[model samples]
Target chain A: MVIPITTGKGRSSRMHEFWEALTDPHVDFLRIALLMGLLASLAFGMTGSLVVVKRISYVAGAISHAVLGGIGAALYLQTVHGLEWMHPLLGALLAALLAAVIIAWIRNNGFQREDSVIGAVWAGGMATGLVFISKTPGFVDPMSYLFGNILILSRTDLYLVSILDLLLLGILFVQYNRLQALCFDEEQARLRGIRVGWYYTLLLCLIACTVVLLVSVVGIVLVVALLTIPAAMAGQHVRSLGAMMALSSLLTLFFVSLGIVIGFLGDWPAGPAIILVAGVAYLLQSLLKRVAA
Target chain B: MSEPAVIDCTEITVRYGPVTVLDKVSFVVPERRTLCIVGPNGGGKSTLLKVLLGLVRPQSGTVRVLGREPRQARMRVGYMPQYVQIDPLFPIDVEGIVRMGRLKGRGLGFYTREDRMATRQALEEVGLWEQRREAYINLSGGMKQRVLIARALVNNPELLLLDEPTAMVDAHIEARLLEKLKELHNRMTILLVSHDATFVSGLVDEVLCVNRTAEIHPVERVRDKSVTRLYGEPVQHVVHGHTHHHGEGEEQPDA
Candidate 1:
């Protein structure tokens, strides 16, 4: 259900309407959407830091784009094959993990030029997703999945996001040192007897999980923006990875919250609004830093 | 007889798809002695180091580092790679980088108090303890190289392998690093690889020259014959308190 915008009403009334929609017991989708955004910020902050530091934003981008294939397949399967249990989110997770593993394998094995393989996977996954999406029965709006509607998210997505956040935090707690080593210097990590290949694959898998979490908030097309922008911004000011993660998490939370408010106020799509705030903030920060320097 | 060998390799051969990088190379480095492997670029100096680090497996060879297989002895061996392999923009500090040396394949655990202590000691040893909190990217090239040394020393390993530690540093930093290595020579076995013969001439107990094949010569023998033969060109040889420039320049004797 689209939240009706009081176009002719004053700004205060619109905010009141948003606040009421959030607190109303009978209508808690807005509250749920806000909670989903906040929880997803944790995963985004951490994984995005890793993606930026390891210089694998391209790999993360590939994984995010590839998620479309899984979403499309799930939609097709549920509609055409009568597989009621095939959730699009599950399909997205699987496809993301598969794409991550394949990319990691190619990188470890040196089977092909890594960029070429990444390019193929990036384009191939999108094409596959589009084909499956078109083949599905009924009038499904692909735009909703390509660019998400956080306002329409269900309680189920919220639970999934919470669970993923916990899993990501737990893994990070245990593997922080190794992951740091892997990102900093794989060869030294190897000499220190850390399994570089396994850790690399594991890092990618974590990135995959984070991408799926992001998909729920920003959809497929804009997922890379949210995954990278806040982290990049945080990297500019922070001196260490942990600090970068914390600062980026706060930045993501800020952008997400402000974007949601702006989207609600203007009756705009929340995802793009969030990305715009983040993009503009990043540009302004860069300009300020340059001027100050 | 000589001291028990800390590094013993017999007929080790490494090839990358028929391009033989190290062909039947053999060398022995005794305990507590510094061995410098000097050779030209693409002469398998780095490849030989990888073979010892168990990073590159040779086609046929028996290799022992600290009397055990390279992989088995990896935990007790510290390695500083030739290049600073990390991105300069990486958000890590000197302490963070050095702490990586304490990772021991445990898969999941934080650094222990002992790990912290070792990191401090390593940093202090390299005279970078004051700058431990500094951003690695903000450090000078010399300090960055020193940080890598501190990382390799953090574990207090029995063997330290440094590949071209003086490659990019200026002369002042090189002398400082040379002094640091001299102090370390009293405790651990050091295997340093460099293409520049003059830089390592004073510190090494022996020189292992490699150009696809390998040969070991005493430091005294390196001044005239071995270095000249290995590089296939006349080069400067710095012996104790003396400098000899071959082929085109006069020999300048130092006090």
Candidate 2:
């Protein structure tokens, strides 16, 4: 369906046919993608922007980019070992958590200025993927790794995304106060017997696991941006962290839906288009802030 | 308030890189005693409070509050760090900020009935109950400081460490805050730090002066005219352990 130019434009595109059967207008593919993308962005943005806080933006980038290697490695293992138990999605998630633990261990131990180490890991992982894919028997496409194809919205991806979104929401609902205390002033939280370090480690692992799957939908390049920019705008616009999270989610959905439509109509890429949409919104917000100031 | 010492620091030494901020400082805060730590800039007064509250680590020291380490017993230590250092526009409301104090026992749950009671009690204690749900950004500097103090108090800690609580408030507000502290003095031990030497006396039972060499002053030293006039007489000092002081003191010691 997403094969070549005019293939999707043809009246018989898989998505078009699927949409034609729908009761609503033919804006089906673009609409769902938009809704999913925005929800995905909203969750990611609220989480990602906090990295800019806790002074962990670069650290988070390191983790985010490093997750690529984890996914690639997991995919390779499933192929080579033929692990019957290893589903692609679960394998990807497991690999990411393992990677997160390893990174956390190393950085906390001796790999000081983990940002540089993470950057190294990022480039190294991508390079490793390139090599592994080439050496493997199948002609795997790396474009999806660098830039995701949202059109390939598999049922598995959607289910996993739904679960991840729910997990995030649940955790937030239960631990919003504790997470806030930890994020803003860990000492204060710790002094109150919050186990500041453990909760944080858990948060990082959760974020890493979530990003592993999210990157599949939005890709690494756009994942953090979509997550952060909307939250950043929300941070500026809303006076409360809770409001910021909610607003970020709404804006993410709005921009993503718009981006998906533009991508569909123009036959462009989804990942980059979604990021650009958020980026544009951010720029506008900045302009508005400056003007008001 | 016959409870044992809430904060007991035994030879705590804090260092930032190669610089020693607090060197082998030790103190015992009995229940309901207000301990005031005072010193010039960079004298490690605030650092001591942070270390006491487990905000900063001491290179060498053992701190115990309620018979546990500060980190392990953090729920028992209410801290009001220097409000000047925090971003005032941080996305929170007066009520939301106060609600943050109950985070310890609530852990990851929704604000329970107990948490609401605690938050309301704390806000009421600080006299900000009426402005509970107001946006934090809209508050005056003095009101914001009170809210921070209230947040610390929400956890019902045995010891409260307030770093320069009266720094940003007006004279009248500072006096009002002092009254509030006096009321709270019955509930918990207090450790306060300030540069306003004038407010040192008549507030606290003991004085910790960190002037390069950190040491504790007997309660009577605060009332000493020479010592009071040195920093400035009628200076705000921690009573019992509460720090209560008058606002207008520009007099410097040996200046």
Evaluated with lDDT, which candidate comes out highest?
Answer: 1
Model 1 misplacement above 4 A: A1-4, A8-13, B223-229, B232-246, B249-255
For candidate 2, the per-residue lDDT at B187 reads 78
DockQ of 1: 0.71
The lDDT, on a scale of 0 to 1, for candidate 2 is 0.69
**Ten consecutive residues with minimal summed lDDT in candidate 2 chain B?**
B246-255
Q: What is the lDDT of residue B41 in candidate 1?
A: 80
Give all candidate RMSDs, comma-separated. Answer: 2.7, 5.8
TM-score of each: 0.94, 0.81
Model 2 lDDT per residue over B130-189, tens place: 997787777888888888898988878887888888786667777777787788778778
lDDT of 1 by residue, B80-111 (tens): 87546668898988899898888877646589
What TM value does chain B of candidate 2 have?
Answer: 0.81
